[model samples]
Structures are given as structure tokens and as C-alpha cells.
Target: MNSNQQNSDHWLVRPSTIRGLWIGGSILLALTVFLQFFIKIKGYFVVDGWLGFGAVFGFLCCVAMVLVAKGLGRFIKRDDNFYQGGNSDD
Candidate 1:
């Protein structure tokens, strides 16, 4: 195969992968919205508001945590060979 053909193929998303992600995302979104109706945990620190708002707040908090983790991983990652030949006792 030519280099250009290989590169174009690398950039393509498989149909199954796209379908799986779409199905997974829809399920998660449904579960998030559904949980608000059927589940309640007592909180010592309650923000005075509607119950639906609390679920939205929790979802946002989860998203924020994911973003923070991604940022930290990028910031703290080392090159693959960073310590490959280093002397431990130096």
C-alpha cells in the first residue's frame, strides 16, 4: 500500500467503533438522567435547590474530575526512555 493510502486509512473511524461509542454514550446519558428520579443519598452539606439540579451538579463534577485527571496525566508524563539508563544511586 502507498504511504498516502495508509495514512488515510489510519484516520478513518471504523463503523463498529462509532456505533459502540454512540450506544455507550446514549446509555450513560439515560442512566444519568434516570438515576435522579430513583436514587437519593443523604448529604450533610446540602445545596438548597431542586433535586434535578443536584444530579446535574454531580454529573458536572464527574466531568470536571475526568478533565483534571487528563490534564495531570499530560503534565506529569515522562518520555518512554526518560529513566532507561539512569543510575538509581546517583
Candidate 2:
């Protein structure tokens, strides 16, 4: 095989990248689990501990963010002609 092909085939997946992903995912999972047990809103409109509420809330927030981003893209998105010839149609 050529040097280029060999290099491509043997490209390093750094341990740091793997470790970072594992740690990040673990933390998110742990937070969701922890929040499930210890989440309580004290005061008016208070909600007592509801199992899996944290995970559900987090998932719903993610979904809402994605939907909002998609909706905003339609209004705020621009073509390559944006900012050309001092035409700031933003």
C-alpha cells in the first residue's frame, strides 16, 4: 500500500478524545440520575420528587432547543449574497 493509504488507515484516535467523550457522557448521565433523586422545588407550585423527571425534563429541553433552532433558521438564515457590497440586510 502507498504511504498515503497506510497513513489514512492507521490514523490515530487519540486516547484523550475517547476519554473526554466517556467522561462527558458519564457526567451527563450521572447528573440526570442525581437530579432524579434530589430535585425538589420548595415553595409555591412545588413539585415533590418524581422519579425520572430529571431525565425527562432534560430530554424535553434538548428537543425544544432543537425545534427552536430549526424555526429560527428559517427567519435568520442567509444566502452567500449576505453582506456583499455593504448591503447589510440582516
Candidate 3:
């Protein structure tokens, strides 16, 4: 490695690549939702029949999981030095 030369960055970490990925993912998500208009969806529940319900429900579920995990973390977390010393008694 040359001291004066810059290190090569990964393609996935590049800002342009990240923006392109976001654009592609958004297009795919929109296409799936738009296709629902042409197809007959046999939803098990009434709420599932609403347009964009899947996307909304999925997003809400993810948020709920994050909240639950954060709450649980409070109860389970240990101090930074919890394991620093072999014995609890100094």
C-alpha cells in the first residue's frame, strides 16, 4: 500500500450506489403494490383488503418489534464493566 494513495472504498458503501439501491427498492415496492389493483386479493381479514395495507401493516409490525426489543434490552443489559473483573468482589 502506498502511503500517499487513498484506500479503495467498497462499491456498496459509495453514496451513489446507496442512492441507486434506494431507487431500485422503491420502484420494486411500488410495482408490487400497484399490481394489487389488477389482481383479486382474497384477504383473510377485512383490514387486509385495503390498498397499501400490506406495506403499512408490515412497517407497523417492524416498528413494534423494535420497540419491544428496546424495552427488553433495558431489563437485560449489564454495565460496561460487568465482566471486566473476574470476581464480583473487588
Candidate 4:
């Protein structure tokens, strides 16, 4: 019945875990961008050859997807008790 019941001092909720995750992600992003200089793109798209292009593209795509999902949620979302005819306790 309590919100903290699930967390219960889990490591995932700790500050160290959050900091480590961000650091790891940044390192991976930087490494991939650095490698893009020597890696030639065989694709027809010119922007694909630019450094950090993939990361930017992927990030933009993710943002667009989240925006679209949020927009659609307004029309598709239902009340928590919509399936139970408003009697959620049942």
C-alpha cells in the first residue's frame, strides 16, 4: 500500500548508480562519434557521414516518437476504472 514498498532502498535508486549510468552513456556516445571520422558511410545520404550524425538522428527520432505517443495518448488513453465500469475495487 505504500509507495516506498517496491524500492525499499534498492541500488537502482541510489545516487551512485545514476551517476555511473550517465558517465557510461556519455563515454559510449563520445567513442562512437570519435570513430565516425575514420568510418566512411556507404549510404547515399551525405549527412550520414558527419560525426555524431547517427546519435543526433537517433535522439531526434526518439524525441519525435515520444511526442507522437504523447499526442496519441490523449485520444487512446482510458480511465483506470474504464474496464471495470468505474468499480476499480472489483
Query: TM-score winner among the candidates?
Result: 3
Q: How would you order the candidates by TM-score, starting with the best?
A: 3, 4, 2, 1
Residue-level error in angstroms, candidate 4, position 10: 3.8
Per residue, candidate 4 scores C-alpha lDDT tens digits across 7-68 of: 67688877788899999999999998888778865656887767788899999999999999
Candidate 2's residue-wise lDDT over 12-32, tens digit each?
Answer: 455566788889998988877
lDDT-wise, the better of 2 and 3 is 3
Candidate 4 Cα lDDT to native: 0.83
TM-score of each: 0.42, 0.49, 0.76, 0.70
Clashes of 3: 0
lDDT-best of 1 and 4: 4
Candidate 3, position 43, lDDT: 86
Per residue, candidate 3 scores C-alpha lDDT tens digits across 1-90 of 453332376778767889999999999889989998998777899889888888889889999999999999999999998878766665
Candidate 1, which segments miss by more than 4 Å at Cα? 1-47, 86-90
Model 1 Cα lDDT, one tens digit per residue, 14-78: 55667888899879877866786677745556663345665578779999999999999999999
Candidate 4 Cα deviation (angstroms), residue 67 = 0.7
User: How many backbone clashes does every candidate have?
Assistant: 0, 0, 0, 0
- The Cα local distance difference test for each model comes to 0.74, 0.69, 0.86, 0.83
